[model samples]
Target: MKVDLFDFDLPQELIALRPVSPRDSARMLVACGDEPFADKSVSDLPSLLQPGDVLVFNDTRVIPAQLDGRRGEAKIGATLHKRIDLRRWQAFVRNAKRLKIGNVVEFPAQVRALAETRHEDGSFTLKFEGEEPVELLLERAGRMPLPPYIAGKRPTDERDKSDYQTIFAREDGAVAAPTAALHFTPQLLEALSERGVQRETLTLHVGAGTFLPVKADDTDDHQMHAEWGRIEPETADRLNAARRNGNRVIAVGTTSLRLLESAADEDGIIQPFADDTSIFITPGHRFRAVDGLMTNFHLPKSTLMMLVSALMGRERMQEAYAHAIAQKYRFYSYGDSSLLIP
Candidate 1:
C-alpha cells in the first residue's frame, strides 16, 4: 500500500502535551467491524474483556536518554538510541559533523563520555567514563527524550519524569514508552485480576526509530528498524492455551503486538522467542497472532498507523481517524488511546 493512504488531517491543538491527572482517566475509543466507535475511559478496560482472555503487555521502561555535551569547543547534543553494553552505547549525535573517532565529549559536570567510533548510519558508539552506570549518568546529565513534536515546544520538565513512564515499567531499556500500556494503572490491573482476566509480560525495548518518519512513498520500500524483544516459554504456553480455549490474545500496545506477531509461526502458533525483530506490518499482511489491540493514537503516514490500517480496513480506519479528529481526540505519544478488534 502507499504510505499516503493512511494519512489524515490532525489539528495541532489535539496533540496532547501531558497525560491527564490519573493515568487511566484518558479517553479511549473502541472499534469493531461495522460498528460505531465507543468512547470510553482507559479504566473501563477490565470490564470490557472476557474472563478467559489473555492480555500481553510490554514491560520495557523508558530511559532518560537525551544528553548534551561538548566535542572540543563545538557543543554537541546526543540521544542514546540503544544501549550496547554497561559502558558503551549507540547514539544519534546532533553536531555529528564536528565529531570524529577518539573525540571525547564531556557530559554534564557529574558525568563524562567519549565518541569511540562512528557507524555508517550517522550513529556513534559512545563510551562513558564516569563513576556511575550509564543509566545513572543519564539520570544526572540527560533529560527525558520526548518525541520531537512535543519536545520542540516546551523543555523536558519534572512532569515528564513521571508522566512519560508507564506504571508497570520494570525492565529498563526502552528509549520510548509502550504508550498504550501507559494508560494502565495498578488499580486497573487489580480490577482485571479480580475479573479473572490473566495478563502476561514481554519485553520490547522500543527504539528511537519509532519516531522516524516513513520517507518512502510505497510501504514496501520502507525498511523497518530492529528492536530487541523477548517472550518467555511460560507466557508462550499460556498464550497458545488461550488460543485453544477460544480466548482472545489481546496485545496491550503495538510493540507487544509486533513482538507477538514476530514470535508466531505460519500455523498461528506462538512460541518462546528472544531476538531482534524488523517485521513491518503493512496492509495485506496476514496476522498470525494478536486477536485485539490497545494502542495510542498514531502519527499520520507512520508505520504504526499503517499497522492499524492493516488490522482494520484502510477505509474504516480512515473514517475512525476522522471521527477522532472531529471529536478533538488527542494524538501521538502523549495522546489518548484506542482499542481495536478486527
Candidate 2:
C-alpha cells in the first residue's frame, strides 16, 4: 500500500512536550471495534481489560545514548541506536560525512571512540577506546536520547532522566522509551492486580530506528531495523496457557506486540525466542499472538502507524486518529495513549 495513505494533518501544539502529572492522569482514547471511541484516563485501564487478560510489557530501559562530540574541528552528534557488543554500538551521527573508518571522535568526560565501519543505513559503528564498560562511559558522557520531534522543540534537561523511563523499566539497552508504558504507575499496577488482570514482561531493546520515517513510497520497499528481544520458556508457556484458557493477550506497546508476533508460529502458538526481529507489520498482515494493543499516538507515515493499522483496520484507525486530533489529544512519545481492540 502507498505510504501516503497513512498521512494525516496534525497541529504542532498537539505534540506533547512533557507528561501529565501523576502519570496515569494522561488521556486514553479507547478504540474498540464497531463501537464509539471512548475518552478515558490511563487510570481506568483495569476496567477496560477483562479479569483473565494479560498485559505484556516491554521491560527494556532507556539509556543515555545521545552524545555530542567532534572529529577535529567538525562538531558531530551521535545517538547510539543498538549495541554491537560491550565496547561498540551502532549510532546515527549528525554530520556523518565528516567521519571515516578508523577516525577517532573525541567526546567530553575524556571519552573517545574510533569511527569503525559506516553501515549502508547511514549509521556508523563506534568502538569505545577502552575495555571499561561502554555503558559506564555513556553515563558520564551521554544524555537521554529524546525523540527528535520533541527534542527539536526544546532542549533536554535533568528532568528527562526520570521522565523518560517507565515504572517497569529494568533491562538497560533501549535508546528510546516504550512510550506507551510511561502511563503506568504503582497505583495503576495495584489496581490491575486487584482487578485480576495479570502482568508479564519481556525485553526488546528499542533502537532509535523506531522513530525513523518510512521513506518508501510502497510498504514493500521499507526495511525495518533489527531489534534484539527475548521470551523465556516459562513466560511463553504461561502466555500459551492464557490463550488456550480463552483469555486475551494484550501487548502494552508496539515493542511488545512486535516481539510476540516474532515469536508466534503459523498456528499462533508462541514459542520461546531469543533473537533479532525486524518484523514490519502492515495493514494486510494477520496478527497471531496479541488480541489487543495499548500504544501512544504515532507520527504520520511512520512504521508504527502501519503496525497499528494492521492491528485495527486502516479505515478504523484513520477515523480514530481523526477523532483524537479533533478532541485535542496529545501526540508522540510524551503524549496521550490509545487502547485499540479489533
Which candidate's lDDT is highest?
2
List TM-scores for all candidates, in order.
Answer: 0.97, 0.99
Shift of residue 237 alpha carbon in model 1, Å: 1.0
The TM-score obtained by model 1 is 0.97
Candidate 2: regions farther than 4 A off: none
* lDDT for each residue of candidate 2 in 166-258, tens digit (9 for 90 to 100): 999999999999999999999999999999999999999999999888889999999999999999999999999999999999999999999
> Local error of candidate 1 at 172, Å?
1.2
The C-alpha stretches of model 1 lying farther than 4 A from their native spots are none
Give each model's whole-structure lDDT.
Answer: 0.89, 0.95
- Candidate 1's displacement at residue 111, Å, is 2.3
Cα-based lDDT at residue 227, candidate 1:
89
Clash pairs, model 1 backbone? none
lDDT score, candidate 2, position 24: 97
RMSD of each: 1.3, 0.7
